[model samples]
Target chain A: MKARLIIVVIVLALMMVVMLVPIPYLSKPRTHHITLDSQRYEYDPGRLEVHQGDTVIIDFTASDVVHGFYLEGYGIETRVEPGLTKRIEFVADKPGKFRFRCSVTCGSMHPFMIGELVVGPNTTLYRAAATMLIGIAGTLIYLWSFKGEQHE
Target chain B: MTKIDLLTAAPWLKPILRSRLFQPVLMLATLAFFVMVILTGLFGTPAGNRNFGIVFVWIVWWALLMIIMVPFMGRIWCTMCPIPAPGEWLQRRGIVKRTSGKLSTLRWRFPKRFRNMWLQNIGFLGVAIFSAIILTHPDVTAFVLLGFILTGIVLSILYENRVFCRYVCPVGGFIGLYSMMAPLEVRVKDPSVCVTHTPKDCIIGNEQGYGCPWMLYPGGMQRNTYCGMCMECVKTCTQNNIVINVRSIGSDLTVAKERRLDEAYKAFIMLGCAILYSAVLLGPWGWMKDWASMESVANWLIYAAGFLFINLVVLPGAFALTTGLTRRLSKQTLSTRELFTHYAYVLVPLGLAAWIAFSFGFALVNGSYALVVLSDPFGFGWDLFGTRDTAWQPVGTTLIPFLQTGILTAGLLFAINTAYKIAAQYSQTHRQAFIATLPVTGFMTMVTFILLGLYLG
Candidate 1:
């Protein structure tokens, strides 16, 4: 019984740690360079992670047809054609995960053409993770408690 | 199997339900919208968010189906589905009421081997594999819709009584699975009444209405998995025994004998698909999106293999392991196969919640685009409603994470509760039951965590 209790605590602690670990965002804004390559329907390095107060410079190039890179929440959207590079510069003032998708109709699977820009101090992700852990914990506690109360 | 009759409470709904014109009329109206969506698909703007077909079908109608219809009303959409309407009308040889003459086609029996959910499962996977294309491109969407209608018509001509819907429609597969949780059901008022009542008009049909289109015997129907809610059973019952009931959600989940491997696999596939969809469509996984969208034939093949393997083998394998553990831990005398199948039902609520949660990510993000598309359906620069140029604004963008967390939490709770209840079935001792539930709960919790990482990470 003692071993089981210890195991349970360890499991809860590990889960809580995964769900509640804080991200350290740089206080000062720094300029970062990112190269994004687009093929039939995807962007290379599909995820770009940065601190909240960073300046992002992205060199977007298309390997095939004309593709539009429309970033949600950042108000930065551009069209990059084959053999031509579209350079965009924007400040990462936000702290969340935002999708940057192909706005142009490239082909059959054009609408699903998407990428992500994740800025740090991403609290919602942590909140959501914590909520899920809590959900599991809450339900288990209730079921166990209910069973105990019934004395069956 | 226990149900409370809605007719006993409302009483007046019987007339509306009995009227043969009601269902077809609703079908006709939806048909207009359906045709309009198809037309827009063929001649609309190339941009998906701006086009009516993609917006309305994927975002609007999809949202309604996941968040409302399937959750609240069992097989309600099947009652007035436009895909099977024209063929069904032609088969009956009339639009509104039952016609006197024979149906206008060759009526052959659908093969017995293909009658199971296996075909529907395959059909759903076939469409799901190309979902990035089907859910996006207007031409593809239009063609898919047209294909379904034509298939329905051809099946109606070749076979008898909605073989297309009962055994073929891809959408019906998931809807049928989740519709088990819906509060609304059409069942016999008393099974005794139908058992003794010989020469059943509900099965053979009378002048009042046609035989069951969904190919279900209303008498022994304990679950809403197959019943299409067409009211044909209600209309044709000479003894007036068929009654629609407003009962508790998921009352069918506990039905033991009605469970099947096909339906259980469907639960796994749906849950897996929901997780994968969240990752590819809503997650930060671009390479996965590329592979899923068939960026190349090779990449697509790999993605398809992984997708199938995960859905068919991985999820089920993991679940079977968990169920096996539960059985072992409980010291139960029941067969492991029975326990596995029954435990799979626990994922139904979780799957439904996952789909709804995953939907909110895109549905809310792109939901506002529906308004713009509605105003300019054809996208020929026509602003019929003057809202054509509505800017791309994601509704509830800030609230999505919270909403998702809350929804996921609710789903987990339901699943855990279901797990405990299922464990209770095999275990006589409360201690044994609690021991049985522990591993499954852990597995479910881990599943929720994966969803969290996908949606919230």
Candidate 2:
């Protein structure tokens, strides 16, 4: 039982370390100019990726109707009408995944019109994946620690 | 450890359960909201975000159901669900005050072959296929809800109690499946007391309450899957044998004898739908959303076919291979079919967690609309609650990834633990059990990775 307890402590400590310790990235920040197309219920280039200190310059256009872009965690909001190009620029300092949604009540599916912006390296996803693996392994070892006693 | 009966733990609960006004009052209260939801769906704005039906039913109610009610309270929602209330009240000939007579129904028996969850599985899939439309279109939501109530009434007229809920309600299917993992359960406190009691009043209604509306005998009920937690048995148990207990979660998943293929399929369908819904609604996939939203009939047809194939064939076929590998590794004596059904129990917690995580993705983001819609239910610019001008804001956006990670990790761990317990049930030795669990654990781990990829990738 003491050995099992020690194993559990070791596994949990390892998981915490993997989750909390930040990893260094070598990619230098750069600027990217992109045209983001907006339509009825979706966005062109629905996914955006950039380095942690990169500058993102978007020439946003709405095709079929009026649309609004609101990026979570960045506090960037813009409105674009048909035949008009809205320019928005921002620095990607927060390094994680954030969702950009249609702010205007466009149509029946307006609430779900969503896109993602990832500022790499996406350490959260990696850490989460690793945590899942370690958690599963720890659970299996704990389950195996029991003698062949009938549970019922 | 022995379970804590809530009635014994808190003596006040028994009186509340035994009151004839209990279920009816709860149903009437929710029925008011149900009526408003349908009314708004029929006459509200076409934009889903500004509409009460879309915001309340899909975001607010679904969040509460997935995150709170199903996990903590078992089938407590069924006790207060207003869909079958009108039909049941008509059958009983009164509401709140019990009527002293046989229920006015045709009393035709439900078909024996259809007694299980197969119809519900099919019904849920049918609704799920058109969910993108039904969820967005107010009129469609209203019509679907109307269809459910009408079917309940018709079933009540044709058959005995709650055949629609027990056999056909689409939402009830997954709710019942996941309710097995809830800490709450309705059970008989003592088998000896039930056995010695004469004239089981719980089955035959006394003046206090009607018989089990879920068509379950409290004496024989071993799981929360079918027991609706309606408290009827509590009202009518002369020996007071029936008690609502707060036990450890997932206790029913180990009831190996009650496992069934139909329920196993329900697990797969729910998990598949959660993943697909996350990818389509929450993921950055425009074409997938277009297909799901029925951009064209042909596109929709392709989407429907693919959806059904994945839910019915791909997920189950993969799990079957995992079970086969477990059987081969452990040399367990059980047949492959039995192993498949037994092993499917692990998915209950994982599927519920996936849904909770998926709900968090959209629910918190859109939940602000609930306030706006409450003030302007019809979106006709009438600010009844003085909050119509409130701006749309996504809540808890930063916390979502962390929440999803914690939930999915917990689910994967629980699923692996369940896999080991199930393997132990069939294996002669602990080593063999651990070996048998590895394959299924690997499958669940892969599923967790896919879900995490969708949520965080």
Candidate 3:
């Protein structure tokens, strides 16, 4: 029982350390020119993936109706009209998934019209997944230690 | 492992629970909110963000239900639910005081075949398929709520005692299923006392209260699955045998004998819905939303067919295969079907966590809308509370991913524990149980990975 408790404590401490540690990224940052198309309730490129120091310049166009591009965590908002182009540029400094939603109510499902921008390295996802693996391993170890103790 | 009777722990609580006015007062309070929701839904602007009905029901009430009430208090919402209030009152013919010697109803017996959660499973699917529309349109929200109340009233007039909630209501089914995880349960202090007493006042009506309006006998009750916690049994128990005890959370999941396939299917459906809802609603896929919201009839038909298929067939088939592996690995003589039913209980905590994680994503982001809608309920520029013009601000955007990660991880740990405990019930040796738990652990781990991927990136 004492050993099992110690194992549990060690697993939890490992998870916390993994969660708090920052990962080193080796990819060189570059400027990327991307085109974003907007329709009634969707963005054409629904996801944008860029390195942490990359400069992202987007030429956003609305094909069907008027739409607003409000990117979370970046504080960038632009309005695109049909038959016109709206340019938005920002530095990919924040290294996490940020949602870009339609600020204007376009239709019934307008509130849910969303797109995602992922800035690498996505340390959060990696850490979470690693923590989950550690948790399961710890649990199995703890349960395996309970052999012959059930009848005690 | 330890039972603390809340009635004994807090003596002041017993009288409040036993009062005839308690349930009614709660019902009336929520009824007032219900009426406001309906009225605002009918008369309010088409913008769901500015409407009281949409913000309150989907954001505020949903957060409360998923995050707090269901986890901690069990079916306490059922105790105060206003949907069945009018029907029950009409049957009793009075509100504050008990006036009916017999309930005014036709007393038609609900068919025995329809007693399980099959109807609720189907009904929830029926509503869920149209959630994109029902969630956004205030008029549609109003109509659906109206439909629920009307069905409740019609059922109440035709039968006796909360048949609507027990068998037919869509929301009530999952609440009852997940209520198993709640720490609080209303049960008998001593079954021998109930047996020795002749009147069985908990089952039959006495002057103090109507008999268990959920139509369950308090003495024979073992799980929190169908007990609505209306406190009627508390009021009517002649020997003071009924007690609301605070027991260990998820204790009912270990009761292997009461496991049934219908409930197993419910767990599958809930987990499947949570996954699909996250992908469709929160995922960066507009075409999926277009199909779900019924931009075209053909697209919606395709989406609905796929939705039903994944929920009813694909998810369950996968889990059944996992359970089959568990049975074979453990060398258990128990049938695969039995193992499947018993092991589905493991999904309750993870399913709930998936829902909470999903809710935190939107409800907190959209929660500020509740305040705006409260002041200007109809969105006609009526500032009743003088705070109608509050701007839209998404709270805790930086903290949400961490919260989601923690919740999903905790849920996975709980699910693994539950899986081991359930496996132990079928195994003679601890090694056998550990072997049996591996396959299910792998399945749950995969599910957690999927949810984490969606939330994180």
Task: Name the top DockQ candidate.
Answer: 2
TM-score of 3: 0.97
The C-alpha stretches of model 2 lying farther than 4 A from their native spots are: A148-152
Clashes of 3: 0
TM-score rank, highest first?
A: 2, 3, 1
Interface RMSD of each: 3.0, 1.4, 1.6
Query: Order the candidates by DockQ, highest first — what do you get?
Result: 2, 3, 1
Q: Report fnat for all candidates as fractions from 0 to 1.
A: 0.52, 0.73, 0.75
lDDT of 1 at A142: 58
TM-score of predicted model 2?
0.98
Instruction: Write one digit per residue (lDDT tens) for candidate 3, span A33-141.
Output: 9999988678989999998999999999998889989887777887888999999998898798998888766777777888999998888788889998999999999
Enumerate the candidates' DockQ scores in order.
0.36, 0.73, 0.70
Please give the clash total of every predicted structure, in order.
Answer: 0, 0, 0
lDDT per residue as tens, model 1, B1-457: 5567987778898888989988988899899989988988898877677788888899899999999999999689998889999999889888987887666678787888987789888988888888877787887899999999999999999987889998899899889999998999899978999889898888878899887878788999989999889998878998988888888888788787788888898898899989988887776566777677776899999988888999999888898898888888788777778888888888999899998898888887677778788788877887888898887665666567667877887788788878787777667777777788888788777888898777666
Name the docking class for model 3. Answer: medium
C-alpha displacement of B100 in model 2, angstroms? 1.4
Worst 10 residues of 2 chain B by lDDT: B191-200
